[model samples]
Target chain A: MKKLQLIASMMLGLAAAGSVSADAGKDTYTKVCAVCHAGGIAAAPRYGNAADWGPRIAKGVPTLYQSALKGTPKGMPAKGGNLTLPDASVKAAVDYMVAAAGGAKAAAEPKADAKKEAKAEPKKEAKPEPKKEAAKEAAKEEAPKAAAAPAPAAVAAAPLVQEGASAADVNSFNRLLKPAGKRNLPPPEDGIHDPANDGTHALQPPLAAFGSLPKSFAGNRVNWVEAIGSGKIKPRWDRTDLTAEPIVMDMNVVREVKGSMPDVVYPHKQHTQWLDCSNCHPAIFTPQKGANQISMASILLGEKCGVCHGKVAFPVSECRLCHSKKKDLVKPATAAAR
Target chain B: MRKLLTGLRGGLFVGLVLALAAVLFVDIQDAQAEYGDVVINNHSDAATMRPVIFPHWFHRVRFACKVCHADLGFKFKAGGNDINMVKIIDGQFCGACHNGEVAWSVENCNLCHSAKPGTPTQVHESTIQKLAQPSGASQKK
Candidate 1:
């Protein structure tokens, strides 16, 4: 008897946790949806405004679902750019939103009408003209059913699998997720964002450019990159130059100079964007290095670094760029010769 | 008929001799030359010849190969460029860099292999300057 009571209480707790709408949803609405919907930009219905929602709610839950899912001229982003939320969750959010706007009567009226329609459907088989009405209602019910199930399954599977996979694999998986091999829409296309739903929009990865460079300048600095990663780079109030943090990158060029030897943790990316790919590929480094003989002797003879650095790109004349730690190795004669 | 056979045999012999000369000429012309002042008998061989001689001054100005070679394709190894010379000529091996827009026109031979010493090489300084400049919202382009 005690075990049965414990099981009943656990089930109740789980149900409460599932249904208890978070203030995160409200916060998300303020941040993302409030942008257009609050001001009625592109005729988007206002967030807390009842007049805009009353007519929409009267059209019933499925119509509102269609407007949110398929999108409307209201300029509301598909799923409010929160692709992480399940379709059912979005519907619940819609329900919460509409109820908040004094449209509870319109929201509650749908189930009563659905019950009435359900009762009247059986009666329609006895009557001739009513069959058309029953069929149309049945089709309406089927549409939401078709749109709901697959989306939740897809949303649930996409994030966890991607959390660990390489960026290339995630891109390939995204392609596979598309229907019929058609171009898939990005997160914003579905009027949904995952972070908007769970107060964790902080975690959704931005669609960065190749090589993890931010596609936009909004997050230009390395500190901003950490900010986008999840304010986890530092405590909420702390500030530090993350790029200036000491980086000891050990790279080994395969058999060119020394196979499997540590390459100085040269501040590479800092200097890379400074030059072109041709600077290295098939050049200082061979298309294949072990195939060619690139020796330190060559670099010293004004051929590699000696060729231009005394003149350009902060010259190898400044040895500290490469040998930032081993300052003693920088010979004064070498600097004088340059 | 005897005279005709003699002429035919002579013509065949001439063709064989010419073919042999042509092969020798190609082998010498396609041989790898010493790079910089570095000498490496251990690394040098006939097979490694014509693999490619990548020019540094021409490339450093335009791109960082780390983006392409390390980020895009895996690092290369020896004997990797067992490629058709014609394909490379048409835009494959060194052709990747030799593409006219990025660096020297592949059509010019001595541009890459100029034997002259102490000739100051030109690097496109503006390209480096442009890359170093922090790109704003325009980073997408």
Candidate 2:
């Protein structure tokens, strides 16, 4: 009886913890949605602003779900950019946002409407209401379903599997680079981001054409060059008149970690080359100096520089790239000799 | 009692050695790669024989990395950019901005043609003064 009670209590605890974490949309909103919605970047509707979300909510929950899932014409990317989120979690976030702005009535009914529409839309796996009946396997189904959702506003999310894709291939790159037959990359279209015409580069990954690529950037660069040379992948940078003037932040501040190592020169100009100011500012790193308690340990665990460096950009193994010496550090005699 | 004391002393000695080794290891394995001088000698020393010694700290204090790296397409690796006299003469690579408009022209080759001898090279006093002076945000065409 004691064992039974203990097990029952543990189950209750797990359920309560999951509900508390998942139900509070505020956490999701801050992490994923705030990147775009906090400042209404790229015309994303601001959070809790009724004027912004009400019209979007009025479109009904299914339409909102479809728009949120498939992506909207008005610059809202499918799944709000962090494609790691499960459909249920995303739905919960949307519901939270609606409740905050459009009131409780707006939150409750659209879910019913979404269920009504999902039942009518397709006869694939027939698991329409991921919220109610299928809550048992929800955790298991989270990853693959997210991956199967694929291509921001580009492709219709067909039911790739009864459950989600493998938990291993959670990131988009894995799915994109999944070994298939030779994939043909489409020509770079120019209509979505042409402020005049709304041309953008948000295209479906050439999944059919893509075979497994070398994981490393150096490896990929070699493959890319080989593909271009052999007429496999089309040239992107060459033969284009589009020249972007690189923005210089001129915020070159050297942070000295008082340790055995030399001071770290945080090159504002270097990082801002590929990323926007907001990408790192107040998110990965606070704009204020010494605010971020960065260490080699956290970086290795994929928090700071590890987020991109090891994954996509150059790895941290090339340490000399950032921990540069100051101009005054080297003696004139040493400088002249070198 | 003698055996126990000997064992304790030996253990203490081993612990001290380990601690010393750890300190030295920390010093040797400095995660931050001390930024220093870069010697660019692609064709400068090989074919034409005039190595281009790049002043890194000078350029960094003034402009961002992307200006030369991304916009100008200058590679980080020394001699990796495949820069040649022809590329610069045609107002392409180095000539794009250094066409006597944004900076000195390619005609003045000796300015960069000088080789390094391992002594730390200093930036021009005028360059430092210009950097110290606040400049407008207008981008060069």
Candidate 3:
């Protein structure tokens, strides 16, 4: 199967190499980036949002060029996941996105040549310095003006940024001072049904491995819920939609085990966020409970949920990811002791 | 004040039980070092119905890791390679040895593309001979 794709890619590469044109970039952006950037999908910087694009655009077209040409650590795939595109076309699309989000100045910017882009590493680190220093100076100057401005850094950040820097660039620079602005918003909603914002009655210890997986392993469950709950990271999918437009399906399955293990509770709503209903329905798991024979052995062998868990998605090694609740087991030892 | 005290007592009890549960379960968590075999599915559904299962154990017998990885630039991570059929046919990546001269031509589709399909119901079988006897490829200097 890989061989066939290899051949097909070869053909596509040949075709793409021949038809490489400047206009292809706009077409590429429409096809690839529009989904994410247009609606702020997956926290992608919305186009024309100077605040979001400010810091990124400040990195110069070359650095942004490389991220789009290669890939971001946050799972934005190279060439927007269309691997067959020529490198020129990928860079072209990057410029197109930068311009759309960053405004006219980014569009007029010259193309980033490879050697110059590669050598531009020093500039990337230094780009944010002026903004940071300016912000500090603003704070020092403003100490006498008023008791305290809510976000003096953000307020004074306009003069720090170059005139042409887009809103995104300013937003990126101001994002640094955002921690100081945390208190500005109204207190988070509090209720037993809703997760608590403050650590008032926090139960779990500091989740060390909440941000990223330490190492890849089978059965390693990357608990999205725990990760989101701990406030270390947010789910890429639209989590807020769950509140207003809820889609709930409570699937409880009790498997016959030799000893004691909690029954599997498959919540349909969580999976629906990232995947379509058809991805798993009649094809992967039968609709009828007690119909399919699911076991740990089959999962390890790459059947059922194993299809996504360890491969493209997180691993299943973390047992608690599934058996979220504790169960009362009938123990013969306790009865015998009595 | 009494209500507040009751709530505090409940919270403490829950926290203690959860902490104890964490300690008991920490030992049982999977700390095994070795990784399972990788199932390459990039192009499985592209041509034939099945994906290729490349067993590292099978290749570890034949060649030094450096030969295919360092020299040839085969990425150690799975799904890292840009391996398309044209490059392979031109003697790159798997094609380095998979050419008929070195091993077998890729003409026989069933030769290596033999793993279970992503579809749930598809039954699969592996013909890649697992040598019960010691492998001869390991002796290659």
Candidate 4:
């Protein structure tokens, strides 16, 4: 009876130890590594693919750990771009992946105590199967639902799972519409700059300079137009020639829409303030009225006016902002008939 | 006979108004992308990765079109340029700036491959269906 009790206690201790490391590895992988590894992105070894793991495993476990720790030139960011993760946790995640790919023997050297634990709980290896299936299902179902919903404008708005790894949707692509907390981080802290570089740490934070700028509701919450007009910011018009002046065309092109929405009055004055005429002419737009087939669909797809509006400028969400010109309701019937 | 024509006109007006409302609602729902962002799927789908969403405006504001279009050898058409990892790490195309010197290196995969899963390589699907519909409001012109 005493021997049985001692053996039972030992089994429980081993199981707990094994589960702790396994859970930690899974958590880290799900939050960080899964973004690329799960999909084999950029040729990242897919999770649970023994065939993919065979060649990599032959290279030895230390090499795998080194690759994960330092990152590869083929596009694996060091520590999977989550620099906060401890080295031990990353190594454990690697072990977890290696064990799953039928390379359990290779991963046994580093964690000898967990060897028996891992073999005892072989069922734990199969658990990721269900999760992978669910992720694939979710990916599959999301496509059709996104298509059925109108407007592809929000298509690119899909959350980048890497940045925060939280519930809050981080729009990493658009610098203008970052979440409130993420806005105006210091140069080094901001993902744009290399944190290791001393120059980045010395640079002025954007929030400090942006304080005096005129405020707007959208896109970094600064009214750039108002700032430029008020002479608060004078952007150099040319790169090489200091005296080069922008040919600011004040022309407004009004596009007539058939629906109840107001006609789109595209102001060249605002556009020409920043861009050269050659930027749009001949390439994006033909520079003739009725010659260009400017549709809302094409524009939403990142064409014509969309080349600027939904990207660097204000997003398309502000409807009244663009569809400003009121239709002449009194003179409509004659034009419609013709 | 006169009343029937008047009634027909009234019915048509109501239908047009409803159609217009539907179209506007769709536009509002769909228009969610930051302007000047291009989604590049060219090979990502086959590679089992999310499509790359290139923020054109972010670069455009800092540099002129000629810098990339002429100097860097990037083609004018979307998805026209054959951008691969080999060329990038070898110091060509995006790698010229993204090589841990000018900007962030190509280490961060999700930074570029952050598009919604299954997004086609095209900038946006041309609304060929909407354009084909003869009864749509645009046809009135």
The TM-score values for the models, in the order shown, are 0.28, 0.25, 0.30, 0.38
Give Cα distance to truth, residue A334, candidate 4, Å: 15
Query: Which is better, 1 or 2, measured by lDDT?
Result: 2
| Top of the candidates by DockQ | 4
Q: Quantify all predictions' global Cα lDDT against the true fold.
A: 0.36, 0.44, 0.43, 0.55
In model 4, which residue pairs have backbone atoms overlapping below 3 Å? Answer: A151-B30, A153-B32, A153-B33, A154-B32, A310-B34, A310-B35, A311-B35
* DockQ score for model 1: 0.01
lDDT at position B104, candidate 2? 72
**TM-score of chain A, every prediction, order shown:** 0.33, 0.32, 0.33, 0.45
| Candidate number with greatest lDDT | 4
After superposing candidate 1 on the true structure, give the runs of residues whose Cα lies further than 4 Å from its correct spot: A1-19, A22-28, A69-74, A85-89, A116-338, B1-141
Q: Kindly list the per-residue Cα lDDT of model 1 for residues A1-338, writing each as its tens digit.
A: 53344334434443342355435446556755677777888787777788888788776555565455434443555566654455544544665677577765665444334322433221211111111222233233232222222223322322322232223223433211212111122222211111122221222222221124322221111222233335222211101222322222334332312333334333444433333445455556555534555444554443555443322334333344444333334477778867
Candidate 1 lDDT tens digits, B1-141: 345435533543343244334333332222121111111111222334211223222232233334334433423322233444465477665564456754455666433332222211122121221233211111111
Fnat for candidate 4 (0 to 1): 0.02
Assess each model's interface with DockQ, reporting 2 decimals per model: 0.01, 0.01, 0.02, 0.03
TM-score of chain B of each: 0.33, 0.52, 0.55, 0.66
The TM-score of candidate 4 is: 0.38
Ranking by lDDT: 4, 2, 3, 1
lDDT (10s digit) by residue, model 4, range A145-244? 2222222222122222111122223343332333343334444443323344444354445545567888766654556677666876665564334466
Which residues of candidate 3, in runs, are more than 4 Å off? A1-21, A73-77, A101-316, A321-325, A329-338, B1-141
